[model samples]
Target chain A: MRSRRTVDVPTLVREAREGSPRALGRLLTLVENAAPELREIMAALAPHTGRARIVGLTGSPGVGKSTSTSMLVSVLRRRDLRVGVLAVDPSSPFSGGALLGDRIRLVEHALDPQVYIRSMASRGHLGGLAWTTPQAIRVLDAAGCDVILVETVGVGQSEVEIAGLADTTIVLLAPGMGDGVQAAKAGILEIGDVFVVNKADREGAPATVRELRHMISLGDRTEPHLWRPPVLTTIADRGEGGDEVLEALDSHWAWLQEHGQLEERRRARAAGEVQALALEQLRSRMGSPTEGVLREVVDEVLAGRLDPYAAADRVVADLA
Target chain B: MRSRRTVDVPTLVREAREGSPRALGRLLTLVENAAPELREIMAALAPHTGRARIVGLTGSPGVGKSTSTSMLVSVLRRRDLRVGVLAVDPSSPFSGGALLGDRIRLVEHALDPQVYIRSMASRGHLGGLAWTTPQAIRVLDAAGCDVILVETVGVGQSEVEIAGLADTTIVLLAPGMGDGVQAAKAGILEIGDVFVVNKADREGAPATVRELRHMISLGDRTEPHLWRPPVLTTIADRGEGGDEVLEALDSHWAWLQEHGQLEERRRARAAGEVQALALEQLRSRMGSPTEGVLREVVDEVLAGRLDPYAAADRVVADLA
Candidate 1:
């Protein structure tokens, strides 16, 4: 085991690129920490990015997300492609506990050098899941993963964010998880590039797929050549329908590249990442609440002597 | 119909405090916009706040959040106390449609002059739902609403945020909502001050409450004096158990005051609001993508010449 103090970023990046899992894990940790050497590592890996096909899978809980993800990994591995999985759970603080379960589920890939799986908890990070996920994807991409799968439980702002990070976003649904109206209310209908009705053997599977298709037809498709999200059925636990899902994903990627949307999407992703990082840096530089202008303003706001808006103005003026 | 350009802050504040619903609505709109006159309005209303008891209601969709909120409003008004409701839907862009439903359910109080209801959509705002919510609460507090209820769907980061804004947070669950495990997974179990199993007439009500109690017992209570969340049953549709719910809220409020936690909570809330506003101001100052250093840095990032972290550093250095 390398001591924390002795771990070197350049060496780790090189080793990761040379297919060392330990080195890749170390590099991921560095990126997750937004380490001091992040700039050096990212600059080194920039030339190697934009090669991996990034796919995001998200849906409500109990939708067989884990089972579907595991099945997808198996299918991809069957083709001898290097695959990486980042299972991000934003609500859980017990990363170790969830990771153990994930490991058990993906036991087949546990010893496979070509398949890398990791779980990231959203706690203890200054920039929630959104800020950390892209960097993690970049590390996997640079480490030569052919297809990187990013899966998150579809609830909250994180689901929308995963859409921005992935080249193709697959939204999973299960029978009796609620009707199509509920899905629309959750805002998942808008972000999905492809919808999967997992557990197709269940009673309401056909209804769920039909509901999704109906909702998609009703959605705003103002773009002349907008991609219509396909609703597919899958019995993930039985490892059925993986081929069809893969076909849909590949078709989406092809359409994106053919329409020149791939560059546009990546550029947008890069811009968002840059903007978020810049904002986080500014927040960090504002310093802690010990004895700064920020603290003073907070004190005033707390005392009700100054409004939050005015206090914010003072802090901004002082910093700028 | 008052023109936006001619709305006077002092006059509006005075009228709102003097019991004019129109003035109160206008003040809410102003605060929601983070208008130029926000400081003046907040300073004027500062003395009037901390008088209203703030209650937050959150639960999964189909868990009767809207019905329960209306029922709670009825219960509070029976005491002849004025009430205000802010239905914050962070996912929707069509605020007007949702507000119409709220108004219909609250039609009994539509002309009551003592009850006010508004829906805020999270769109076109730099500061998200968290930042805008407290100011809106302040408007209701200043308008002399004896009780203010803030309701939000309990799926995302917003539920945690609502806990910070409310003096008491009620987490509602209905029967067959996938057991208590789903509640725990949603991260609501930790933040709930009081848990309510709504739709008590349903088949699985007792089991749901039992599951909640079991989960609560298993929760880690590091603080010796930590408050134990009480699980209660309620048929909100029929207004059953409203008195017990009210009593629980009152008891919790008393506990907070006796333990001297009220001041600490309010101070923390104020600090958070201040911090969020300051961050928003900084982001705004970074300017739009059309021009400025921010745009230049984004261009570099998109071109892959400069990594996001380095670009962020340059922007921060330039601004600071």
Candidate 2:
């Protein structure tokens, strides 16, 4: 609801790029709000976008996702990389519990100016992640982050949606959790670019890894040109296997570049963003009745005088 | 992809109404495939829909959903009402294991001509249940099903989506599975018209029921006219508590009638159906580029010559 005239977009973007954390936070807040100034902000930031390599980590509730993310953030920092962490949970909606817990676990890097962390809840915006995520990623990308980790406390569809925003998606699992079958059932296997079986010292780590490998082999991406995801183990709490995970990420990135798939993926991501935006515009138009549009149609539908299909047709025709 | 000429929508609809199960099955198949004949089929069946009472039953995997549904179907049959059962697994896409299991558990009614059961897999269809269910419900309603039980092997968002189609939603839960918190988190508490603690013979049934009531009490539906859901316990495998569930359903239906909620819910369902169909049409039009619409925009996006927001504006403007 913030007016466009009150906020100066160019100065904010400049300050954000010049390493003012307040400006960066304000930009992301605007992205989350889907405010009136977002179009101007995005237009200003468009030139600086597409620089950050986004890595997404997703798993079920107790798969050590945040711990692994924190561990990975530490390792990335050790390698002198400025990192931005976007923590989102698809299942625990509208509540701060999950995002708060995610932040607390990663509190180690809170003081580091190079490490930026923000938690986004996919509560009631409908697409959960989609409506705000792509724009938020552009903000972080423009803010000079070398790598942005999109970590999600996800259960089902949100994980897949998160993968759409990421350059490389990591599916995290833990030992002895029936994680493999659950992972496949959730469709995480198809979206994963790198697989990590965290909690390596736990009972069923090797078995989980073996099951994942066997399933990956059975996948239809059997052509030699495709990247076969390596299933690695990590005791992330103890910081044991961050190096291997990072190595896998680098290899996937290299393979993406070698096959010219990075360009392909980026284009697809952009197309998704464009399509989502167009849909949003169309949906908003459908909502606002301009001289007897949605209101009359809904009334007729309620009276059974107009079937819903016909009602939608009327709405769409009136979208001009 | 069957040709429209081959499928006579009128004949199929007539046969389905006259109790031809094969015709009913074929109609549902058409819905599932989203065949070209769907619009014609929907128009033909629209007059007959809004008749059957749709009761959605949802919970986690081992909460005895199919068994409870079968029990309810048998009870409805005892009252000499034709029944239809739709079994779907939102978590399981492109496979038949869960649906097969659902069928096996409901095999007791397979021999009854009055009871029709169909299993739908939400595979590859982007909207899953949204694409197939409304029309499927129409087919079953026109097929003379007085009651339709929508049983789901749901985990996350599908549970919420299924509630949209139902007249009265029943959220099933087991006693010992942290069912209360999980149900609230999965958003069943808000949608459930009746909460059933199934498998009541378990050790913690009382505690689960208490927890559910506490949560229900905490919800915002405190108005005196609103229907407060009762927490019921069921040992469905033994066929116990079916009468109580049926009685609760009857009371809720009466409440819906007295308060005119049934009409509102049906209209809302119609509106949702209308919106989904409209979106689908728009998306298809977007996909099939006439004279270089999406292709050029995507190419520009890939080249970073145009930002996705501007590209979206261009696409929407080109839609005319």
Give the candidate number with the greatest DockQ.
Answer: 1
Which digits, one per residue and each the tens of the lDDT, describe model 1 over residues B1-320? 34569668889999999999899888888776667788788888876777888899988778888778878888888889999999887655323324455445667667778899988765424434666789999889888999999998865566777888888999988988783457565478878999999999989888888888988888885477878889999888798988889989998999889887777677667766777777777777777654678778767766667777887787777777
Model 1 chain B: worst 10 consecutive residues (lDDT sum):
B93-102
Off by over 4 Å in 2: A1-12, A93-98, A102-104, A179-182, A185-189, A288-311, B1-8, B94-98, B288-291, B298-307
- List DockQ, one per candidate, in order: 0.36, 0.36
Q: Tell me the tens digit of each residue's lDDT in model 1 across A1-320.
A: 34567567778889999999999888877776667788788888877887889999998778888889989999999899999999888655323323545446677788999999888766524435667888999899989999999999865566777888898999998888774448555578778998999999998888878877887888896577999989999998899999999999989999999998887778668766777787777777666554688788767766667877787788777777
Q: Can you give the TM-score per candidate against the true fold?
A: 0.82, 0.89
Local distance difference test, each candidate: 0.80, 0.80
lDDT score, candidate 1: 0.80
List of chain B TM-scores, one per candidate: 0.92, 0.94
True contacts kept of each: 0.44, 0.31
Among all windows of 10 consecutive residues in model 1 chain A, the one with the lowest summed lDDT is: A93-102
Q: Which digits, one per residue and each the tens of the lDDT, describe model 2 over residues A96-164?
A: 323575467789998999998888766545465777788888888899999999988655567777888
- Comparing to the true complex, what docking class would candidate 1 get? acceptable
TM-score of chain B taken alone, candidate 1? 0.92
